[model samples]
Target chain A: MSHPEQAPEGRRRPASPTRALAEPPTTRTPETTRWRICREVIIHRIDDEAVAYDPGAHEVLYLDADAFEVFKQVDGTRDDAAIFLELAQQHGETTDEVASRFAPVLAAMRRHGWIGRTHGADEVS
Target chain B: MSTASTIGGRDVGPALDGYNPARRASCPAAPGPESPTYYRIGAVTVCLHSADARFREPFHHLYQRHYIGGPTLSAVHIRVDRVIRARPLGRGFRICVDGEERFLLRKPQAVLPHVEWAINAAVAATLPRYHQLHAGVVARDGFALVLPAQPQCGKSTLTARLISRGWSYLSDEFALIDPDTLRLDPYPKALCIKEGSFEIVDAFCPTAGALPSYEKSWKGRVRLIDPQALRPHRTPWGVPVGMIAFPRYVARPAPALHPLSRARALFQLLDVCFTFGRYRAATLDVLGGVVERAACFQLESGEIDATCDVLEAAWRAHVPASGRPDPADLTRPEEPVRPGVEAA
Candidate 1:
């Protein structure tokens, strides 16, 4: 747009701790990838949908019902594989099917710094 | 050296004619003695400094309701001045905002639009309080429909069509969402009719042809039609947002509206929000609230009349069956009737 949207202002909120670790979440993804929601990510949920904001990264994201369901599962206690397995069992699908369906969503959340790997999830917002 | 006084029972700031030329307020780009004109645009105070009538006259004419004959008291300020230079290379105008040069225009005719752009820039950068989105906003019966800006969207054309069809004009350029109330505030600048849709809009507004047009690089020419010329009065308060329609211009003979997911609307709106960077988390919060109760749609804009028909239907669908506010209600968020007085 040619309008007056200025160059994004300098980041005021704390930077995501996961920044130093990976470029795209895929490079750092291994079998034992524990994920945790970023401490400051604020999500506003609509009917089966949501919009997520990571203040540090200055990203506003929309979550479909599937993505919202997937994001809610990232509570820092379990690895991505385990979460997918549990979700698969709950929905009566195979682990591979669930992984293929939700792997991209997890990757996107990680890519946008809405979720971080296990070690970096302990930082205070 | 500005003063506030009343004219016809209305408050006015120090207008150019009555103000001292030697006293400069904010903008410093003008080279000669300056005639600074001030206007109150909602919660914002805009002061345009220029000695030339070409720039001042149009602003005064279009923004007549908001004109002030005195300086502002507490409103947010955005000041712009034009510096005309006849250099060895070419003649151009340097558009300045708040004592800083923001844009350089090669043609004098382009000064007005750039001045408006300068104001838009200042609002986006300076005001971290309001959630500013680059979109066209219009309202009906106290509820508003936000037309988020996009490539070839033809939002202004649709905005003019809506106004001609009895919808209130909030703005053709930006939607200022008040952070406190989470309501859509009026930026209510002129409805800019691009050259391509002149014939389409002129059919509804015939007097538009007599108005002078400006040269725009991509759009060829644009006429900034005053909103008041089309509508009698504007609701000078914040209105609740009821819908978000992302319009796309299609060559088909008829217009269409498709159901859009709230998530997608929020995503698209976030893309068009101008002050999203400044407000950060608050921007998302406000937008989420805005789209929460609003019906979202993707508008395939074809003919103006057909497009308006689709929009009016969408607007009508959102309103409750009873106690609907009047579309012409000059003030909105209608006072709830008392327990005993509701049915009367």
Candidate 2:
């Protein structure tokens, strides 16, 4: 997986307002490894939004367009760096800019047990 | 077997009209040992056996045309009677089903409200076949419009207005939908007009004066308007839902109709359905089909006429000409008559 520093030239621009607002704090450990969507999470996309129903938790979540795209990419194989790279390519932004925008959202999803870290063994919190 | 009469080309059994409480108590309807008054509300047959004379008048008035008499099975059996000797200070009466007390009436005047409450509870308890939603339902041109809202949202007022203006009244309190087909069944009970909405309903329905209002009840000053009086013809029992609307009565200049996305509509429906948890997957699937086939909207209005206009326009636009079913096609066989004995 490519790191944020290896983002291609010409795609880098000033961070958008959402990226600035969603910027992760430096004290938190960077989530470099790949994250997989929880197997129990069932997602149904309607129009621009997606509704995720977790049978285990009996919880229903509403994911907006950007977050829904991020969730849809969590297939257990891709690392966070790779997911951000693809999102950057799709939205015409640098990998660093996409990472900044999705960093907080991804961390929150990990905390909520919506996604898990895959490092030889699955770890979901 | 009791004598039957054909009303509007449909066979109906003798109503509890001429039988005073004393006469009813002396000779309950036969074929059974005890006399239980049988009344049909749409598809549900309720057998009410109450010895209290106080429950007779209001029960007759509220459920006038719904009485049926034959030898069919009853879906629910409800009994209401005085708890003890009618002392001035004693608790008034108790409503029970299978000897289990559901509610107690504190005064003679509170009998009607308690009976209505008890009947609703009985239906909720006894009948889990159809999925019930906390919504108001009305239909026009072979398609039903479902108004799902929380209490005090002016749902009954709007429903009464629309029904008075020629839209067929299905129900005001609960919208019963078939879990398999998503077709809405009509539960045309008396429209419970609250105190705040009396003026609006009276203006729209001039014949509403004949209906009496019960004061100091559970829902404040409440009046029950018999939908039959407004539209004397036999209305349809079921209709394919064509539209799902969430109405909000706001202090606005004009009525506004905002389109709702399918996801939002589904979420709103799940929130309002009474049996969502019991039939989760089925309810979700049925709701998806309903949302797909129907146009969903959020209506905000203070003016009743304007709101009706908006709904009618939606009906014309969305419900196709070929898709409209005749009212007669939607009517079911006259509610089955059951042998019930009238108790004192």
Candidate 3:
């Protein structure tokens, strides 16, 4: 079983100073990037929280209502901007406000290896 | 057709009669020692062979009432013998099941207590064939009432009181529910009564004075109550669950029974399960079916009588008017109920 915090082998590594500076600013924006859920996770919704069971790690993770909504929207099809827009429409808030509020949550999910870029969905190594 | 005598309308072999611990202790070692006692509790069978005289009498007195004299096959084989070489602490004994050592006690007097613990461990290990939960169970009118609670929550006291008041004893430790048929089987072993509960239980059971009790042990003063003595000639069998109650002992004036949603009940049941994590999805499906069919409650009480009254009423109200199906009919397999996702 793989540790939840450890990234898989052969994945992308941190960019060096020159490569970081060469990267385009638009590519870092949430508008053009889409996310997909990990293939080894099984989620069951309970009340306001969703329980995610990872078979690979034999661990159960909890996601509150807001985080669960974020998880539901990461279906490998929608960009972060589109998910934020949909959630903002439901909560009667602007897309910018929703994005600002959910930025930390999305970062935490990425760090936990629960979500990844949709373009690398098949590259699980 | 067996060489056992009938007691309380049940067959109990002459194992207790032929028991001569002193002679057996002095006799030379044999190539293989055969057990003289056999007992059947619900679906589990126990065969005990002891070379130590100190453990024989208490073992006989504790389980004589629960003896199964007929042709019952033994599933668990236990042998207790004293250590030949003396240590600095002196004589000691070790308990083994099927030739594998399971427990060792420094003092000979601790043999009885260790035997109880060993038997419970053996039973727990054998019950993984069914979905097992840490709960106290009692039944009446074919409707089983499951009381799942944490330790020191007054589950055993309540169970003893209910059984003394005509409720059939199912089990005081584990509720083994068949995963395929969704029926609860009775695992009626001896009920372990703690110190503070002696007076309460003694008042209810007339034969409590004759039962053997160990003092100054780990759980304070403890006594084992043979359920068969309370309800003689009764066969412990499976029954459909009618209610699931989470009991809490509180110092209050009156007892209260609060309704619990199926989701909350499922969560509570899962929290008290013994081996659910090994079979995650299947266990959830089976437990979802259990909570759906059984009404759930949270009971808080200080008085035993009042608490039992509330439970009886709840059982009466929740059970179907057509009554539960016959135990013989419940052996057939049934489809698992779909999991219900209720809002938390």
User: Evaluated with TM-score, which candidate comes out highest?
Assistant: 1
- Per-residue lDDT tens digits for candidate 1, residues A1-125, read 32243334532222223332233444657667678886477776766667777676665666766677787888877788889988998889999998887776677666656677775545331
- Stretches of candidate 1 off by over 4 Å are A1-29, A37-40, A94-97, A110-125, B1-35, B74-90, B217-219, B321-344
- RMSD of candidate 3 to the true fold? 11.7
Q: For all the predictions, what are the DockQ values?
A: 0.18, 0.06, 0.06
Steric clash pairs (candidate 2): A34-A79, B35-B341, B35-B342, B36-B341, B51-B344, B72-B338
What is candidate 3's lDDT per residue for A1-125, written digit by digit as tens? 54443222211222232442343333244456678876577665544445565655544444545667788888887778888988899889999998877654565566556777765455331
TM per candidate? 0.76, 0.74, 0.68
Candidate 3 TM-score versus the reference: 0.68
RMSD of each: 11.6, 14.2, 11.7
Tens digits of per-residue lDDT for model 3, B230-339: 65636457687888899988899589988765545665676566656566656666776787677778889677888888988877767654665322222111221112
Superior by TM-score: candidate 2 or candidate 3: 2
Which of the two, 1 or 3, has more lDDT?
1
Which of the numbered candidates is closest to the native, going by highest DockQ? Answer: 1
Q: Give me candidate 1's TM-score against the actual structure.
A: 0.76
Looking at candidate 2, what TM-score does chain B attain?
A: 0.79
Candidate 3, which segments miss by more than 4 Å at Cα? A1-125, B1-34, B69-74, B84-88, B215-217, B231-233, B324-344
Relative to the true structure, how large is the alpha-carbon lDDT of every model? 0.68, 0.66, 0.66
lDDT of 1 by residue, B171-220 (tens): 88888888888787787777777788888878888877766677656657
What shift in Å separates residue A83 of candidate 3 from its native position after superposition?
A: 6.5
